[model samples]
Target chain A: MKNRKIRGAYTQYKDNQVTPEDSYWNRRDFIKNLGLSGLAAGSMSSSALMATIDRPVNSGFNTAEPLSTENVVTHYNNFYEFSTSKRKPAEMAVNFKPGNDWKVEISGEIEKPGNYTLEDILSWTRVEERIYRLRCVEAWSMVVPWQGFQLSQLINLVKPTSKAKFVAFETLESRSVFPGQKRGVLGFHVLPWPYREGLRMDEAMNPLAFLATGVYGKPLPGQNGAPLRLVVPWKYGFKSIKSIVKIRFVEQQPYNTWRKSGPREYGFYANVNPKVDHPRWSQATERRITDDSFFGTKRIDTKMFNGYGEQVASLYSGMDLARDF
Target chain B: MSYLVYAAIFRLLGADPQEEMLHQLGLWTLILLLSGLSLTPLNRIFSIPKLIQYRRMLGLYAFFYLVLHILVFFWFYLDANLAELFDEVIKRPYVTLGMLATLLMLPLVLTSTRAMQRKLGKRWKKLHQLVYLIAILGCIHFIWQSKSDLNEPLIYFIWLVSLFSIRAYFARKKAQ
Candidate 1:
């Protein structure tokens, strides 16, 4: 596995050389091995159990890592088609579209703002394989080997102005492309045309948040934010906008999709802080996506900032997370 | 599940202890939602005059899955940090909707018994109306829960909309 070098390009040029089912089985094995080991010999209290379980799985390639194309495509999602519940995304997102002709638009505070196609973007940035521990705001998680590059490179190339205080993202809007966009089922109020999200100037520029074009060293499947998507590792999963088409650098805080819908529930800075409690549920713990069977059973503790305090903690220096939360 | 747990202990020595729990919870949620939806139709169609009997069990099961959902979230992922749970429910609308949908169902579940329903009277229907609200909220809850994709919630909403519309149509027809 180490000897092989996966392609570093976008556009689903062709079906993955390795089959999707193969990846799924591999991921299942990876999940089985990692999920049962520590939990088996534990007499720890609930709190202690959570701390031990919550740590992200940092294993090597052959040591049961669920970074295959199938696992990347099927698992790790917030898409709730099967159930409104957490597990729905993975179950329902399986039948999504996968193809070429996908493109991402770049605009806003840039001097040269235009529609830079997916192919065009891939031509510039070389895809680097980086396995990131994704922690959602809902307290669920997954360790994904994401294949993309620093978002700063794209933003820098655009030459954003000094007035740029944040980088706003927009996902593709096609009633045909996305079945949910056509049907206003969740709420008639939410716009189906363009789903948007924004990140702080520094957070957007952080090397951790990649403008992911691919996953598992291959092109991203349509189900998993195909073409191009944003991956903000530290914050909740929603912060990372998927299937993006527009990038706007703004002086003011852009209206995020969730925050705009319900300001009280969603905040502008959705950093994954374990200190705040969701009015209806607790964000204190999470379930790693890789744990297929026990994925629902094993709950792990959350860190202050998804365990990236050393890197992104200063961003929220004096801000009251609970109040903002 | 108990049998599976027992068998796994001896056979699949390294079986995930939490696997059955997760499956049971998931299946329970599915059954709860389905059964909860059936109450109105069952009462009207079948001679389940006291259809309310099943409401609590169904609602409680839904709540049960929700609890499992939250437990799995906190235990396996967040490590039981009250603050982080607070942050997520407060900071994320999808999580909020998910949370609200479950929480709203609580009072309905709590007050679902025959005695409580008798005590509450007309207020019972009013309170239980929360089920419709919860179903809607649950749909929204699931819809937003999806970070980008919206297919699952869309399907659920289609079914829910049809169900509600049918109920509305029947009610209007009955009034006439």
Candidate 2:
């Protein structure tokens, strides 16, 4: 019984509680007093259980800097399926239902290709918190703490064949949910749906590549790509496709939505390179969106590979970044 | 007049006020300038000579909003950095086109006074004709600056083309 109790404590620790001794003891006392009925009530629903989960485990990937406030992180988004405006997604997505029965279809050049529900996917991998700097192609950026597992973990389960050279992702297509998909004479035909993005096989397996399902210690808001989304930190934010439903491992480089929409402006690789400027705007500096003062946002010189050069620079050793960009 | 109310509504909503303000100002500038250009054609078509009286005020208001647009851009985007603004004007093609359009309006604005218009005589008509070119440049500036969503700019472009076609038809008739 004593050994079982010790193992239970270890399992609890691994579940994301990384508090120091004092807080841990205090929490233990609180749980002890709450008794069996309170614990049962908390675990009755997945969301309620998630609520008890601590706000982002210190996965050691977080930057030394403080995370952006959850309010700003949740409110500001670039989910163009709802609307092109940054604020529109937050507003319109309130009506969007990501539904509890979400499933991801994984196929192409994989041994274990099948449709896996969100619960099955979650059960297969270990989720952890990773704070990454998200840099948009439009010269704006934010630091967000994402809760998810590494893309490689999911990739490993599928067991890619030698023929699988690229990994393509596709977002959900529902005109009923995504009002932006509707055709109108006055509406802008900027992007073709459903949104698509791809990564070279090696890039997909990179340590930094993540499949996020939650943020701020809760299930992701619909606007922020609930259920599943790709998070490729080294690339421009557009490359990180959101609300993904399909993952395909293919032989050739797949067509990315942004690249298809604006070939001259958005390149296929979409790496965060400062040297290459968009036709309409310069990319040398980025406005840190979190730093909003009365004067304006703080502009900082954009870092090559978005300050992840140490980990990602070697990936493009032989290629010219400017040309690829 | 309604533009002010629209701006007030935007401000109250607590949206990205800077971006909305700049967009609205630039849009009104184009609208007013185009409206000013339409005045002579309207006067000719409807035989209402007094309609031309509002032309100068409309043109001046267009220039007013343009100046505000530039000021907002400078204040928000560049943090009023004159050096960086100069660099943008030099390096960016869209900025160059926009600035050129604004600069071309300067001479017209100066000569818009009754005293100067009377002093220049026939040259005044020829000089004020720059408004047509300015309108074209403004459309190009807007279209060029658009990243993707060219619907609005395309509408403006079609408007300018139709307006020019009407003026051209009248010009040919006058020559005949």
Candidate 3:
């Protein structure tokens, strides 16, 4: 078995004609060989970068199960920006245009504050691929291969001031595009518009805190927060705000959208803790949504810190998760 | 009739057919229960005795759908795992209320026959009044299960309240 696996890898490497210098020329040549135009090639290569990165199972994470199919992951989403239904986000998000020339504004308590374009941000750090379990607050989960750099890298570049103790994130809000934001019969008022989320300074700087730009080896679909988004594996999926437009370094904890809309049900911290039940549902178990079958989706015990306890459990050692949650 | 059509459509094209079917079945059960309760007031307002003939059919339909809803939850959601079903009923308050509502319907359904009704005489009227309690429990179960967006449950609550208020007003007048 081992010899066969090694042989397979060797064959793959030989087929790709990989060499030390191949990394530089392979991208351009590969895209040009596909007959794509210059503009199309640039976007395709950036998204394709995710597939090129090594995904050896790192210690303290689960990679036993196969990564969920891109179809299931993309079609099933809780992006309330587009619609409330799990299926509607992918459908209605067709109208939403995540412009290629996106600019993220960094301000508040940071030494170097300015509007940085997506390209400028990409140039600041090297992107790597990480397989993480994304557990939704709604008692469902998906294992996704995310492509991005550690958020700490970006935070370091901006040089947060000593007084900055928290990091607040804000997503793009366009009423004309985001159907949920419109104030009419078609709109949903379950959550405050322009979703906001925050994390403690230590948590924000944690190696696990990632800013994902792509998924499944492609640029994020409009439904799944194109361009850039946060991915804190241990926290509930809502904490990973999508289509982030602003990153504020602040002294106080920011008001998160879910917390603001329903304080009793949603909390700012929003960690994935089975012991802490939501007001209406149990958090002990989750339905691992894959493709639907006759037997239905599988239900599994939810792990504390979403199975990243060894890495992140100490960050909240003294605080009460139940209270914070 | 519409409920069956909706269920068929959901089965054909829904992303999560089991979930959609469970929701639709539970909703129809509640709607039919409320409809059964409405027959009396509707008959009185119209001064027509013909509507009373449909009451038993509506109540039976409600019970039928309620049973199907529970079965769907057991077979699809729990995969027919009796141990987990028992655990869910004990652990979750919403599940408990739902089970209680189903259990309460059993006695009413058993005594629904003409022979059983005749044998009990006046006592049957009091026994059948359990439907009101069942309706309340059903609404509570629906409301408790909702995580957010209480609009649908809230509408059910308002409908139940309106039906009870009308019954209460008639009972007071009858007393005088």
DockQ class, candidate 2:
acceptable
lDDT of 2 by residue, B62-119 (tens): 9999999999888877768899899899988989999999999999999999999999
Chain A alone, TM-score for each of the models? 0.74, 0.81, 0.81
Q: Report how far off residue A247 is in candidate 1 (Å).
A: 0.6
- Which stretches in model 2 have alpha-carbon errors above 4 Å? A1-60, A184-188, A291-296, B1-16, B45-50, B172-176
Deviation of model 1 at B16, angstroms = 13
Off by over 4 Å in 3: A1-53, A59-62, A182-188, A261-264, B1-18, B46-50, B75-87, B168-176
Question: Any runs in candidate 1 off by more than 4 Å, and if so which?
Answer: A1-73, A80-100, A184-193, A295-297, B1-176
Model 3 RMSD in angstroms? 10.5
Where does the lowest 10-residue lDDT sum fall in candidate 2 chain A? A1-10
Per residue, candidate 2 scores C-alpha lDDT tens digits across A1-325 of 1221222111212445233334434544554455544654754443233235443223324553334456557777788788776778888988665643578999999999999867667767877877788898988777787878899999999999999999999999988888877664567665789999999998898888999877766667888887689998888999989898999999999999988888888998889988888877888888676522222346678988888887777788999877788
Tell me the TM-score of model 2.
0.82
Q: Put down candidate 1 lDDT per residue, B1-176, tens digits, no spaces.
A: 35545644553311233433544554456457756886777677676878857766777778877788678655544557788778777777767776787788779877877899899999898888878877777777666554444554577778778778767877988999
Model 3 clash count equals 0
Cα lDDT of model 3 by residue, A1-325, tens digit: 1221222101212222222223324543564455454544445543343344333334433343445556667877788778766778888877555543579999999999999977667767766666789899988787776777799999999999999999999999887668766543423365678899999999999889999877766667788887789999999999999999999999999989889888998998888999998866678888776554433367788999998887888999999888988
- TM-score per model (chain B): 0.77, 0.93, 0.93
